[model samples]
Target: MKPGLMMALSALMATSPAFAYEIGDSISPEVAEKLNLQPGKAAVVDFFASWCASCAKEIPEIHQFIEDDKSEKVQVLGVGVDEDLAEGKAWQKQLNITFPVYDDTDQQVVESFAPIGMPALYYIIDNKVVGKRIGAVNHIDKQIRADLKELGVEQ
Candidate 1:
């Protein structure tokens, strides 16, 4: 390959995750611990950032879902991938997110998931990824509800 092409490829590779978690992929033990995922419980891991407009829009809906959820069969967790911890915390407070959120200032958590888009939702059970939704989604709460049902996590 040409030198310019090689440099471009190197840059892309440096920015991208070595591997993205997929359905049925088991999350590493360290990451599982960081998220505090329980063995039997189902969880919806949402990855977001302070600068993502789509995340700003979807977080409130997710919070609504969390409020409306009474079954407790599934837990919705947020991973704020902002480099600035203070900014990420401010965003969470602004959104009034009540569900548990992990501040990923070092980016280890988000790097482990390696979602393809700004706002990524991963459905996990027993430390394994069961489903995923990438990018900005319409009616994300509803979509999550349906996805949970499909995953046998009754609302």
Candidate 2:
């Protein structure tokens, strides 16, 4: 290949977003309707997996974040990308989470909103996603707090 072509390819790969995702995009119409049916005033979707250690660690912070009565306005929905529903449910149980979890083993949701990493957060205000965290490693709390502020959601 020509040197210029090689350099161009390298630049494109380097500049690509961490994940193959689009923001400010609406979910599939069907999913949107299902989410709308849920009782929470605000809906935030978390894309996670049973195998990711990072996802495991963020569970408590997410629980604590939603402990207040304000959570009635804010419902946290967890989408487990695990291939097996039973395993994912077990992990959810271990986390002591009381929210509903859905299975997306086919990666339908994952493809539509490619998360940067496990425990990725998509902040949905009213019914649309307005803020997001690609990945925060061990720092999800600080970043989520900022995202909440951006959404005008008090902690």
Q: Each prediction's Cα lDDT score?
A: 0.89, 0.70
The whole-model C-alpha lDDT of candidate 2 against the native structure comes to 0.70
TM-score (C-alpha) between model 2 and the true structure? 0.73
Q: In candidate 1, which residue ranges exceed 4 Å CA deviation?
A: 1-17
The sequence of per-residue lDDT tens digits that candidate 1 reaches over residues 1-155 is 99999999999999877897889999989899899997678999999988999999998899778878898678789899999888889988998888889998988888878787989999999889999999999989899999999998978
Most lDDT-accurate candidate: 1
Summed backbone clashes in each candidate are: 0, 0
Instruction: Please list all clashing residue pairs in model 2, or write none if there are none.
Output: none
lDDT of 2 by residue, 64-147 (tens): 666643545567778888888889888888988776666787666675677757678787764566777766446565666667
TM-score of candidate 1 relative to the true fold = 0.87
Which sections of candidate 2 miss by over 4 Å?
Answer: 1-21, 34-40, 69-71, 137-142
Candidate 1 contains a number of clashing pairs equal to 0
Candidate 1: what lDDT? Answer: 0.89
